[model samples]
Target: MNTRFKQLLQLSAAALLVTSSSQALAWGQIGHRVTGEIAELYLDADTREKIAALFPNQSLAELSTQADSELSNPSEFWQQTWTWHFVTVPEGNEYSLDKHAPKEGDAYTALTSSTETLKDPKATVEEKRIALLFIVHLIGDLHQPLHSGNGTDRGGNDVKVEFFWQPSNLHRVWDSGIIDNQNLSYTELTKWLSQKITPQMASEWRTTDPKTWIKESIIIRDGIYPEEPKLTYDYQYQHIATIKQRLQQAGVRMAAYLNEVL
Candidate 1:
């Protein structure tokens, strides 16, 4: 092969490796976990029926894969899909903005965009379902601490550090480190969190709304800014419970939103 072709092959191999590695920690894992929990608690009779009708006999993994691929390209559905990929910062920085400083954007934009795709007459049922599912996932992502990161770090992507003696970025830590450290299955973690949730707590957690979710996530980002992330088992130990709670909530709320919509 020519040099260019050789480089292309190398890049493809690396991408595949990264994809395989990410399967365990991808946004989908967290989202689906949340969706499952929320589905259990929040999905109504109709939405549950719809989901069952659309995906009978399919695993969550299968549905998620199908949704992601369909969402990769949408009908002339909404404003660019890329626009929905960000989170908005709350007002109060020195940037001299209004009371509502919009740093990133809102989950509403994403939901609206996804809705547009779903509503497009030309859109396929699978495409619409996938778009709706993405809306479900993005709602959960908007609540993750790093997902609402400052423009400076691109949500900690710029902050390089080591996680358990492994070289990694700060963003990666929040994305996967804490959850992976627990060594619990997603169901176990969800059950663990579900037990702690009181009716009142769930009630309050569900009402915060998406804009509020982003604001809350931004606050968390401040605390998570790694001074020197030499995190080992001890560090993970210190925050293991907290991490599980956050991840669990992500799933719970995602399902809640979808249930409401359906």
Candidate 2:
């Protein structure tokens, strides 16, 4: 093979690796965007105006994938934030911000810190901009049950499974498998979820603390693991409601958080 051809192949392989590995960390692009779009609907006029000013050329839905997009870029800052996409709480144990915090920081700390940054008047526009994007993405990540990992199995990334006869893992299955299978665009999913949210549901979901988000995820995470690693129609049927509910909650909570800070 020619040297240039070999190099091209090597780069393509590297890109594929990065894409697959990153998929395990959070809800996939469509899921995150759907959450962002839902949050956009709930934002108060003042909050929406401030966000528009902070991100002049972009919307929250557009910025929703920025944190994941940064993963492909090599830098100390991105490397240090590698762990912030998910939090690990072992099965049978509860998630506590004080006790369960990762040494490198996790989703909870990142969300809390980002919230403070956006709320601080002294924070620069650039600081608030980055914090807002991260907050948007991390809230979606926190809603993915697998993102609040069980101590073993790297958030189920190690639990090899076949999603609809294709080779995949439990984490990837939850991250995008079910949602992707439906073939809905982010906007379509957002619209569908919006119609389902009742006034009472919105009020209740909006008031939930982050700790409750994690705890609810942990409960859902526990019940989701299949006895066998092979997942098919039955698994999707059973867990689809949980997936929708989490997405809805993530969206409502995100709006609530932004309303408080912005």
Candidate 3:
């Protein structure tokens, strides 16, 4: 092959890797970073200082996607953590920690455990580091309605659909399709979202409980499933507000949790 052809092939391979990897994750990088940015804005000075000490030079926005990045590694620990990004609760049934918890540890358990680890005074810096990263990422995951799934479709990953004439799935639509369609970087999206938050909205969203977050996702999930397998502009128009609302709630709640814990 010529040099140009080889370079083209390499680019194609890289694109394919990214596409496949994204299909398996929650909220995608942009969505997670957006959530992180919002949380960073709301974090109190003490919480920010504590987080800086743990991360040294990194900001929470930079660390927001670290859990997903770790998925690229082939370690056993990473394998075990694969399920921590979502939870499945079948339609018509309420989510109960005692009954619905996954054997492999889903997002709910992971978030709660990670928060505890961060709170522990004896936890090593490395342990706190991992826990904090998980908290940041999992909070974003918990907000994606599909992450708290109906249990029949693998969190909509199995429900293939065409979005704007492009092949996609219901889960992918919520995870990145809507956000990507906006064509904004994480910082831009954060600024836009920040401008909309009212004091009442902030007060209403600030909560430390992951279960409440999951329940809110469940309510949103109930209305989101399309009756058909094709989605386009109308679908985006109908659901975009919910997406923005969830992102804002995730950010506020994450900041609340971090502030209380730290």
Give the number of the best model, judged by lDDT: 3
Considering only N, C-alpha and C atoms within 3 Å, which residue pairs clash in candidate 3?
A: none
lDDT comparison, 1 vs 2, better candidate:
2
Once fitted onto the true fold, the runs of candidate 3 whose alpha carbons sit more than 4 angstroms away are 1-24
lDDT of 2 at 196: 97
Give the TM-score of each candidate. Answer: 0.72, 0.89, 0.90
Residue range 75-140, candidate 3, lDDT tens digits: 445546778888888878777888888777789878777777788786666667777888999999
Among all windows of 10 consecutive residues in model 3, the one with the lowest summed lDDT is: 11-20
Flag regions of model 2 displaced more than 4 Å: 1-24
| By lDDT: ranked, best first | 3, 2, 1
Number of clashing residue pairs, candidate 1: 4
Which clashing pairs does model 2 show? none
In model 2, the worst 10-residue window by lDDT is 1-10
Backbone clash count, each prediction separately: 4, 0, 0
Q: Residue 42, candidate 3: how far off, in angstroms? A: 1.1
Number of the top TM-score candidate: 3
Q: How many Å off is the CA of 28 in candidate 3?
A: 1.1
**Ranking of all predicted structures according to TM-score, beginning with the best and ending with the worst:** 3, 2, 1
Tens digits of per-residue lDDT for model 1 on 7-72?
A: 322333222212212232234464445445544665567866767765676433334323233333
lDDT of 2 by residue, 162-261 (tens): 9999999999998899999999999999999999999999998986477888888999999988999789999999999889988998999899989988
Model 1 CA lDDT for position 183: 73
